[model samples]
Target: MAVKLRPAGILLAAAGALAIAMPVLLLLPGGGGAVPRAAPVPAPIGAGTMPVLARVYERPLFGASEPVEAPADAPRLVGIVGRLNIDAVALVKASDGTTRTLAIGESVDGWSLASLAIDAAFFTRGAERVRVPLPIEPGGSEAGTEETGR
Candidate 1:
């Protein structure tokens, strides 16, 4: 019997030879193989060195100190619609004798409405705050009483 080689057989032999040699070549020394290394550890921060985000978290979102009394020239609270603190609206009489409607955080005549209650509205200007009471009628009822039913 005579041995014969075909294109397909030659290609199969070449592939098998390469497959067997690859692992032996990789295992040889100085073959530029990857070496396992320990992971790097991070250093601890010093007490004097605070991150920017840490400094921001240390400050208060709103001013926490007690506010001074408001000035006499501040606007007067006329009436308040709605009793809830979050959704209440305050009517104020400005120094110029004009009526203005304000909500929490709204500004009138340089004063910002900081909070609201059923009978009072608080306004703030810088470090000063004023508690403007709701107007009272002659019948001993607060203003807007008929509307709010309180």
Candidate 2:
């Protein structure tokens, strides 16, 4: 008779074969149009048009700063703000801390991400969020033709 298998049962069958191979090692860097997307019911970046704020704007005018410039796999800083720009995800801290979100795609100089409606009191903890109130003609604004999110 024989029965042999240990190393914590071969590392518990190699950690259950790597926990069901963790979504194939996270979709193996998705190359064929990155799978798992199916939320279509008349929505693909429209209904008003706006989307671009990968994060980094509690205050950043002209020189810009902060730990912003997300998408390093983006956990949440999916970006967009208007009322000029005030949603680093509405300072994301809900469930009790009372923060909010709804600025989908606010564009002005994002070159045409086209969406704007930001205003969580314009986030002024130390100021410098924006100001171009009717005076800007360098590239001549066409990213949504200024509804006022620039």
Candidate 3:
């Protein structure tokens, strides 16, 4: 007795094979059809608008003090650009050195003291909502330029 392959099964197998080959075909270069290494690809940002990191004052939320290292679409970008800084000012007279006081932004203050729920933003799903802690300092000035984390 010989096993007869059904047409539906054959079609399904063909479909599966095609589905698997789709990526391979796409990766193949036009000329020699060479398959290169699969590198990480970031999703496209909004049209005419890219992801911007929110930054206020001297410190940046997504990058170091360096100007070029900062990331765009950061929460600090929103706060600074929007100029929406909401927090109280605490003045304390210290007997230490000069009259230098430590002032933190509302978001930073909230996060540091466990006042607000602050979690590292993860881009596993998508760039829907990337919450970043606002600047920490009473009169944090705005810094121009934005950067995006790759």
> Highest lDDT: which candidate?
1
Per-candidate Cα RMSD to the true structure, in Å, reads 11.0, 23.4, 19.2
- List the lowest-lDDT window of 10 residues for candidate 2: 119-128
Which candidate achieves the best TM-score against the true structure?
A: 1
- What tens digits encode model 1's per-residue C-alpha lDDT throughout 1-150? 999999999999999999999888888996647888888976766845756887888776875545445478888887887767557798899989999899888998899999987778888899987777765779886544656545
Better of 1 and 2 by TM-score: 1
User: lDDT per residue, candidate 3, 1-150, as tens digits?
Assistant: 999999999999999999988888777777336658898987677645744444344356674465332234322312221111344232222223222222243222112211222222111113333334444444554344345579
- Model 1 lDDT vs. the true structure? 0.81
Q: Which stretches of candidate 3 lie over 4 Å from their true place?
A: 31-150
lDDT score, candidate 1, position 16: 100
TM-score for predicted model 3 compared with the true structure = 0.23
Extract clashing residue pairs from model 1. none
In candidate 2, the residue pairs with backbone N, CA or C atoms under 3 Å apart (3 or more residues apart, or in different chains) clash, namely: 49-114, 50-105, 50-114, 50-115, 51-105, 53-79, 53-80, 82-118, 105-115, 106-115
lDDT (Cα) of model 3? 0.39
Error of 2 at 44 (Å): 15
